[model samples]
Target: MLQSLQSVAFAEISLAGDLISANRGFYVLLQLAPDSVVDHVGPYINNPSFTELAAGAQRAMPGQVVYQGLITFLGELGEPRSLLARVCRQGDHLAMIAEHDVRENENLLAAVMDLNEELAEQQRALARANRQLAAEKAEQQRLLQELATAQAHLVQSAQLVSLGQLAAGVAHEINNPISFVRANVATLGGYVGDLLAIIDAYAAGEALLAQDPSLLARIHRLRERCDLDFVRGDAVAVVAESAAGIARVARIVSDLKNFARINESEWQVADLHACLESTLNVASHELRGSAEVVRQYGPLPALHCCPGQLNQVFMNLLLNAIQSLEGAGNGPGRIFLRTGRQDDQGWIEIEDNGRGIGPERLPRIFEPFYTTRAIGAGTGLGLSSAWGIINAHGGRIEVRTEVGKGSTFRIWLPLSRTTSE
Candidate 1:
């Protein structure tokens, strides 16, 4: 039975550590020939050899087994193996049992540890990849938002260009008739003045006709039916009023032409004050009752810029100011337009005395489609468009505001196109 056992090795030794006998399994496990005569087990038992086993056996109580959990053993060829072993004292000898199956369990545990390390590394790499993916997603979203804003700007610019062309055509068509009407009205006023002089002379000659009573009576009846005195005074006033009205129409046409300079698409030297005045005139109806515009213009050199574009910017700022005031209760509102030249730049400032923008909404005022106004009340692109136009001109817009007070938007433009570029 002892020789037939293949995994458990049994041995018996002297209490003085001499090898007495051993199973055939012990010789086979240690790689020794079956007929080999081993003098001692010291060479085969690498760790906890025969000497250490003997001492451990002596320390134990009588017939008690001491288990050495795992011990390294060497073969005759110096190969190493591990065994779970136990030793016991019996009579004048020691009995030992060692199991070769413990080595398989140790190898399995080592493999499990290596797998755990690889799994941990893979988890760390997945976490880093997730972080990178998150960053890329955020960047993509930002880029998409920018693209949407750019498209909106392009659409708005196209609409403005079309509107400007229409305004220019309309102004041109009105200018021709208005010019002839103005000249004819002036001529009519002169003819009316000459006719009034002749009527006065006829009135003076009527005294001579008083000598003929019947003729005088007839003349007096004609004068009474005609109301000649009132006619003489009212005709001159009516003609003058017509002339004035025609002149006003002509001025409006001129202002409209100036405001929508479709022909002046390219950069050119333009008066900043003139541009502002033309814009104000074009938007006069919007300001008529909503607010009062006060101009505080200073001396400034002509600027190199697209006048139509600048006029559009001015119109936006002015309209914004007017709306701000209109929203502020029933009190009369004031819009102050100020201009000046500082260093190499000329600046135009539009200020209003109305309820101003809150700090929470101030920073994003120039962001596309961002607004504090109620839905449908505003498209929210006016300020942003103005900002874009100024930036394209190598200029900037500065805003100053207080919660309940008002806001001021100052536009700074370079004096020369070369410098601005």
Candidate 2:
């Protein structure tokens, strides 16, 4: 039986998991020495079932097959090798018979390797796609922010243009009536003086009237009935007051005309103080009910700028100051307007004693569409547009405030237009 097992390809192991013997074919397959085969089965077999294989070898009867299956093992080069293997009992020993199944194994390994490569490629593609999507998301966010700013600018510019047109119309329509009324009051003042002189002459002729006592009595009765002394004094005073009032109206209309010149769309030599005065007149209604405005004028050089745009900036600033006071409700508010020149630059300051901005919110005031007011009450583009206009004019605006105290906005403009522009 041993000779027959040796003729076939076979190996024998003891119950203690030691290699007892092996045929010439088995030795050739595993590249093992026949003399060193004993107790060396672990070096050649790759599976962790050697102890169970040894036990099966001891329990099987003669000529009975103990196990039959495909198995893997390590060859002389330490590379994986597969075989069709079987174990059978022969007396007290078990013989393992095996043959290489190379063709079937090669086909199975190629299919598994192709599937793994495909899975790796899929994961790499997914990673690249994720990176691209992240970049696109970032770009979209930037574009959205830019669009919001542009929209706010457009709306603010439209509002300023409309206001300019309205002011121009008002100034034009009221100019004629205001002129005539002013002139009539001036003429009436002279006429009242002449009539009072005539009444005086009649009084001086009282002595001559003694020649006709009846005529003198008639004149005395008429003077007593009409109260001529009071009429003469009151008529002069009334004409003077009317003239002063008309003068004030004319001044207001003139300011309106100046404020509306922003529609010219060209730069001109501008008086900053004059612009401030005009803006104050235009904003008088808002200020009168809420605060007292104090003007501190200074000698400032003329600026080469777009007067209308500067007037718009002044309007926004004044409105903001007035509204701040209106919200405080701590009694009447105070607004201070100061103008000065330093280092050939002109500066105007609009300071208010009202509710001040909190520190956290102060930084974002100039951002487009950012407002602290209720949603429908404010459009939030005033400061943003103001800042843009100032920047284009080569100027800057500075702000200082303390919570519960007040706020001050200072604007400095270039004395001359940039030659490049």
Task: Output the number of the TM-score-best candidate.
Answer: 1
- lDDT at residue 20 of model 1 (Cα atoms): 79
What lDDT tens digits, residue by residue, belong to model 2 across residues 218-264?
98899889988788778988998898888888889999999987656
Strongest candidate by lDDT:
1
**How much is the lDDT of residue 373 in candidate 2?**
94
Q: Which lDDT values do the candidates have, in the order given?
A: 0.80, 0.79
Tell me which residue pairs clash in candidate 2.
none
Candidate 1 per-residue lDDT over residues 124-232, each given as its tens digit: 8989999999999999999989986997688668756876888888899998998888888889889989998987888889878888999889988988899988888
Point out where model 2 deviates above 4 Å.
1-137, 201-227, 327-332, 419-421
TM-score of each: 0.64, 0.63
Candidate 1 residue spans exceeding 4 A from truth: 1-140, 208-226, 329-331, 418-421
Which window of ten consecutive residues has the lowest lDDT sum in model 2? Answer: 1-10
